[model samples]
Target: MLYIVSALKPEAQAFVDHYKLKKSKLNNFTIFSNYNIRLIISGMGVENARLATQTLINNFDITDDDTYLNTGICGASRSYTIGELIECGGVNYNGIDHIFQENRPIISCVSEEVATPSYELADMESYGFYDAVIHNPAIKQFHIIKVVSDHFEPQKVGKEETKSLLFNVIDDINKIINF
Candidate 1:
C-alpha cells in the first residue's frame, strides 16, 4: 500500500477529485481512496502533519514495504520558478543538511550542503517524517515532493491561492511522482 499525506483538504481533494475518490470517516479521521492508494488529509503545519502521518502509520499498521510520501506545496528558493514541481534532492532542516537525492528526479543544488538555496521556507512535518520512516528497512524508499507556492511573501499565498498554485502544478507533480 502507498501511504500519502497532504497538508490540507484542498491538496488532498486535488487527487481525490481527480480520481473520484470516496470519503470515509474511520474513528474520527477522514480517509479518501483511489484504486491502489490511501490518502490522509493531515491538516496544515508540522505538528498537525506529524500527528496525522503517525496516525496513518498506526491505524493502517503500515509495514516496511509501504511507501510514505509527504506531498504538498512549499516555499522555493528564488532560483526555482513559481509552479515548478520538485522532487526534493535533499532537505535542509533549519540549517542541517540531509541529502536524499540519490536516484530520483534531480534538482540543481546551489551548494554542496544546501538542497535549494532559498531563504527559510517552512513546511510543517517533512523532516520528522523522513527521519522516522527511512530507518525502516521494510520501506523501499521515501521522498518529499513539493511545488513552489510562495517566494518570500506570506500575503502572496493565502489558502485559495495555494490551491490554485497546486492545481497549476498537478501535471508536473504527476511526472515527479511517477518518474
Candidate 2:
C-alpha cells in the first residue's frame, strides 16, 4: 500500500484517472484510492499538508511497508528547465530546514511562490507533508517528487498547463516509485 499526497488536483489528476480511483471523504479531506494506492489532495500550503496527512493516518490502516510519496509541480531555478523531475532532499519551512534521506540534493523552500536562487525548488506543501509523515509510526521511508514547472513565475502556469506538466512526466514518476 502506497499513500501519496499532492497539493493540487491537477498534480494527482493523472494517477487518479489512470488508476480509476474511487473518491471518499474523511473529515473534510478528499481521499482518492484504488486497491494498491491512496492519494490525498492537501491543497496548496504547509498547514493543509500537515492536517490532511495526520487525518489520513488516523483514519486509515497504514502499514510499515506503505510509503507516502509527495508528488507535485514545483518552482525551479533558472539552472533547471521546465518538465524536469527532482527528488527533494530537504525542505526549508519558516526559516528552518528539514532534511530527508532521499539522495536527490535539490533543496526545496515552502511558500506560496518565491524566487529561485534562494532554493533549488519551491513549493507550498512539501515541508508540511514531510513534517507530518516523518512522525508516523508506520512510516519509515517517505519520498517527495517535484517536477520543475516554474522559473520564479508560477502565475504564468494555468490549469491546463498544470495538468499537462504532470501528465507528461507521469510515466517517469511511476518508474521512480515502481508503481
Candidate 3:
C-alpha cells in the first residue's frame, strides 16, 4: 500500500483526482483511497500532521512493502522555481536537523507559516509527519516530497495553484511511490 499524508485538501485533490480515489472519513481526518493508494489530509501545522499520521498508522495494518509519503507545497527560495518538485533528504524541526536521505535538500518544518524564506526550503508539516512515522518498525520506506509553491510570499498561492502544482508532479510522485 502507498499511503500519503497531505497538509491540505488542495494538495490531496491532485492524487484523489488522478487515482480516482473515493472519499471517506477516518476519525476527524478526511481520507481518500482506492485499493492500493490511500491519502489522508492532515490539515496544516506540525501537531496536526503528527496526530493524523499517527492515527493512520494505528488504524492500518502496515506491511513491510508499504510506503509512506508526505507530499505538499512548500515555501522555497528564489533559486527554486514555482511548481518545481523537491524530494527532501532531511528536515530541520525546531532547532535540530534530522537526516532521512543523504544529500538532497533539507526542509525546515516550522510551527507556523513562514512569510520569509529564512531557510533554503520551508514547510509546516514535514517534521511532524516524520516524527510520527520514523519510530515504526514496519515502515521501511518513507519519503518527504515537496513542491515549490511560493518564494517567501505564501499569500499569493491560491487553492487552484496549489492543486495545479501537485497535479503537475503526479508522475514524479508515482515514480517515487512506485504505484
lDDT accuracy of residue 48 in candidate 1: 61
Put down candidate 2 lDDT per residue, 1-179, tens digits, no spaces. Answer: 88888888888887787778898887788889988888898988889998888887887787767778888888887889999888778887777777775466545656557754577678888888888988876787688888888897877888778888888887888787776
On TM-score, the leading prediction is: 3
Give the TM-score of each candidate.
Answer: 0.76, 0.91, 0.98
Instruction: Return the number of clashes found in candidate 1.
Output: 3
Ranking according to TM-score, highest score first: 3, 2, 1
Error of 2 at 32 (Å): 1.1
**Whole-model alpha-carbon lDDT for candidate 2:** 0.81
On residues 117-138, what C-alpha lDDT tens digit does candidate 1 reach at each position?
4454445556656655665556
Best by lDDT: 3
**Which scores greater on TM-score, model 2 or model 3?**
3
Better of 1 and 2 by lDDT: 2
**Clashing residue pairs, candidate 2?**
none
- What value does the lDDT take at residue 128 in candidate 3? 91
TM-score of 3: 0.98
